[model samples]
Target: MSIFEYAPAPESRDIVDIKPSYGLFVNGEWTDGKGEAFKTINPATEETLAEVACATDADVDAAVAAARAAYDKVWGPMPGRERAKYLYRIARIIQERGRELAVLESLDNGKPIRESRDVDIPLVAAHFFYYAGWADKLGYAGLGPNPRPLGVAGQVIPWNFPLLMLAWKIAPALACGNTVVLKPAETTPLTALLFAEICRQADLPPGVVNILTGAGETGAALVNHPDVNKVAFTGSTEVGRRIAESVAGTRKKLTLELGGKAANIVFDDAAIDQAVEGVVNGIFFNQGHVCCAGSRLLLQESVAEDFLARLRRRMGTLRVGDPLDKNTDVGAINSAEQLERIRALSEIGEAEGGERYTAPCELPERGFWFAPTIFTGVSQSHRIAREEIFGPVLSVLTFRTPEEAVAKANNTPYGLSAGVWTEKGSRILWMADRLRAGVVWANTFNKFDPTSPFGGYKESGYGREGGRHGLEAYLDV
Candidate 1:
C-alpha cells in the first residue's frame, strides 16, 4: 500500500513540532555521526525540528572511503539494466511516500506544501524514471562504443530545493554506475535522510549512496577529498567560484549549477492577465528562493503603468501562511539568516534611490517572513538590480524598445533564464535569439520537464542537470 494512502491523519497543533535528531546514512545504514551536532529549524515557527550531525573532516574521509569501496566492489561493474531497476524502485518508493515527503519538505524547508507536493516530489520521481530509462541505453547515447562511470562522485546541494536537488544528483550518478557521497545542506537534511530510508527499502547495495549533513565546512571537506573522482555543486556563484578555484589543477571533474538573476520581460502586446499571473508565479515561486527566479522585470515603456497596477493587485490575492497548509501560496522565508540578507538588500535598494513598494499583508510574528517587495525606477547600476536577490523581491525597469529590453536583460554577469510574455510567436523567437540566458519561456514561466536540459551560462554556472545532457556530467570523457 502507498504510504500516502495510509498517511497519518493531520493533528491540530498550535505549532508543528518535529523530532529532535537524525543519524547519517553510511554504508547503506543509518549510523551515529562523528563531528559536532547542529539543529535544523522550522523557518516558519523558529522551532527546532531536529538535531543533525555536523560532519567532520574525518567523517568525510570515512564516507569517501566507503563510496570508493562501493564503486569498486558493487556499483562499478553493475550492469546498466540492474542500475535502472534500482532507480525504478526508488521512483516507486518516492511516489508511495509522496505526501509524507512533501509534508516533511515543507516542514523543514519552508516552501508551500502545494509546491513540494505538486512540483518537487513529482519531478523528483520523474527525474529518476527518466534517468532510469537511460541506464541500459548508454550504448545508444552517441558517446562512441564504450562509456564508463566516473567512479566516486562528491555532491553538494543547496538549501533551496534540498530533496529535489538530492534526486537530481543521486539519480543520474547511480544510473551511470557511479557511487556518491552527498552532503545535504544542514538546515534541510530531513528529506534527504528520509530518502536514505527509501534506498534501504529498495535494498540498494551498501555505500552505493550516502547522505552526510553539515554546513559549509562539511561540504568543502567532501568536495576537496582526494578519493572523490568527480565533484557536483549547486549553490551560490560566490561558493561555486571557490570550488572551481579549489579544484584547479586537480583531475576531479566538476559540474556546477549556480545562481541566477532572471529577467521577466512584458511587452506592450502581451495578454495582460496571463502575463501578470506568469510574472507572479515566476518571481514568487518558492518565495523566490529559486536559483532561476525572475527577479528582474523589464516592462515596455508603453505598458509600464498598466502592468505594474495589475501586478500589485494580483500580488494582494496571494495567500501566505504555514508551509504545511495545503492551500498556502507563499510560505515563510527559509531561515533567519536569509531573511536578514533580503532585508539588507532591500534597504540597499532604497538607499540607492530606488522606490520600494511592498504588498500590504500581515506576517506571523514568530516566523521569518518578508513581504513581497517590488522596486521601480531602478537603474541597471543599482545593487538591487545587479545582485541575485534570492528572495521574493523584484526590480522593475522600463525599456523603450526591443533592443533596449535585450540590452538590459543581457547586461548581467548571470545568464540562467528569462521570460518573454507576448501573444506574437515571432517576437518570442526573436527575443529568445537575442537573450543570453540558458532557458527562455515564451508565454509561461517556471515550466520544467525531465526531458528538458536545464542549466545556466556564464557566472550563473555551467553543466546541465536534466535529460541526456545530464548524463555527460557523470561519464568519463
Candidate 2:
C-alpha cells in the first residue's frame, strides 16, 4: 500500500432530509397503508433511515382504483402533447434534484455514491427524457397507427437499480397514456418516494402515478389486482415465475426483467488488457448486484493463466466501505439476506472443488459487506457458475475453442445478457449470432442506454423494456 494518506471525501448527508415515516402515494396524496410500517436502513451502517409503510391488499386495491380513475378521466383523455409535457417536466425535475436523489439512493441502497451519482441517477433522468419525446409520436412506434393505452399498468421494480428500474417501467407506460401503480423494492424505496414528490412538484394530475412501498406480498397484490391491465416486474426468476403463474388466464399484459447468469467470453485474439478490464466491470460493478451481471468468465485456455493474474491484481485495488465515500469503488451488499446468500454460494463453490480468491479490502464492522471474490477451476456444473449469486463474485471456466466457449456460455437456463471480447469482427458477429442472450455486448460489458431494447430470450424472462418495443407493452393495437 502507498504511504500517501487521502482524507475521507464523504458526500454530505444533509442534502436529504428523511422523514420519520413515509406513507403510500395514492391518488396524488400521501396515505397510510393497511399493513404495518417497516424500517428501511442503510446497509452500509445498518442505521435505520426511515419507517416506510407496507402496502396491504387493501392498499393495492386503493392504488389500482386510483390508477384506474386516472386512466379513465385524467390520463386517457389527455392529448399526447399534454402527456409529453408532464413527462418532460418529470425528466427536468429529476435532473434539477439529481444530487439529492443520488445521495438518497446511495444511503438507502448501499451502493457507492459515485455509482449512484454517475450511473443510476443520470440514466433514470435519461430514460424519462428518452420516453418523453415518444409520447406524442406513438403512431410512428410501429405497433399501429392509432395505438391506445392499456389502463392501469402495475410495475414492480428490483432493488439493484431502484429508481432506474422505476424509470424503465413507468416512463413508457406514462408516455403511451397509461397510468401506473408502482411498487419499489422493499430495501430501496426512498428514491421512488422522492420521485413521487417530483411528480407532485410537476403538478401532475391526481392519480396518474401511485407509489406503493412493500415486500413480495405487496408486489403480488399489485400483480394480481383485477383492475391492473398490464404488469411489469424486474426481480428474481423465482418471483417472476410466480407472478407469471398468478397472471395466467387474466387479460393483463406482462413484461418481466428477471434474473441472469451471464457469461463474459474472451477469445485468444482479444486485447488482453482491455479484456481484463471488461471482466472486472462485468462482475464487480454495483457489487455484482446487477441482474444481468456477467458472473461467469469464459477464457480461451491459451490466455486463461495470464488473464487470471492481471484480474487478481485489478480486484485488489477495489475499495469496499462507506457508500457515501466518493473514493469507494465497491460498497456494502444491499441487505443482510443477500450477503448470506453470497456466503452460502461461495461455500458451495469451495465444496465443489473450485479454488476461491477474494479482494484484500477490509470491510466496515457494522454493515452488510462482501469482498470481491473469484472462484477458479470452476466447472460448468458448479453452483457458483450456474446460479445467480447476485453479489461481487465471479466464476472462471476455460474453453479450448470458440465452439466450446459458445456451448459453455449457452449451457445455462438464463438468456438475459452476455459479453464477447475479441479483435476479429467476423468471429464477434459469429459468436453474437450463435449466443441465445437478448443483449450481447461485443468488446464491452454492462453498458446500458435508454434507446436500446433490453430483455431476454428464454428463462431470463420475456418482452423488451426499452426503445420502441417498450411502448408496445403499454399500448393496445
Best by TM-score: 2
TM-score of candidate 1 to 2 decimals: 0.96
Instruction: Give lDDT tens digits, candidate 1, residues 1-477.
Output: 111222223323333335578878888877778888899988999988889888888888888888999999989999999999999999999999888888888888999888998999999999999999999998687765787898999999999999889989899899999999999988899999999889999999999999999889999999899889999999999999999999989999999999999999999999999999998999899999999999999999999999999898888777777787776778999999999999999999999999988987778889899888899989999999999989999999999889999999999999999999988899999999999999999889999998888899999899998888888899985
User: Candidate 2: lDDT over CA atoms?
Assistant: 0.93
Q: What is the lDDT of residue 36 in candidate 2?
A: 86
Tens-place lDDT digits, model 2, residues 296-377:
9999999999999989988877788989999888998999999999999999999999999999878888999999999999
Candidate 1 achieves a global lDDT of 0.90
> Residue 151 CA error for candidate 1 (Å)?
0.2
How much does candidate 2 score in TM-score? 0.99
| RMSD to truth, every model | 4.5, 1.0
lDDT of each: 0.90, 0.93
Candidate 2 residue spans exceeding 4 A from truth: 1-5
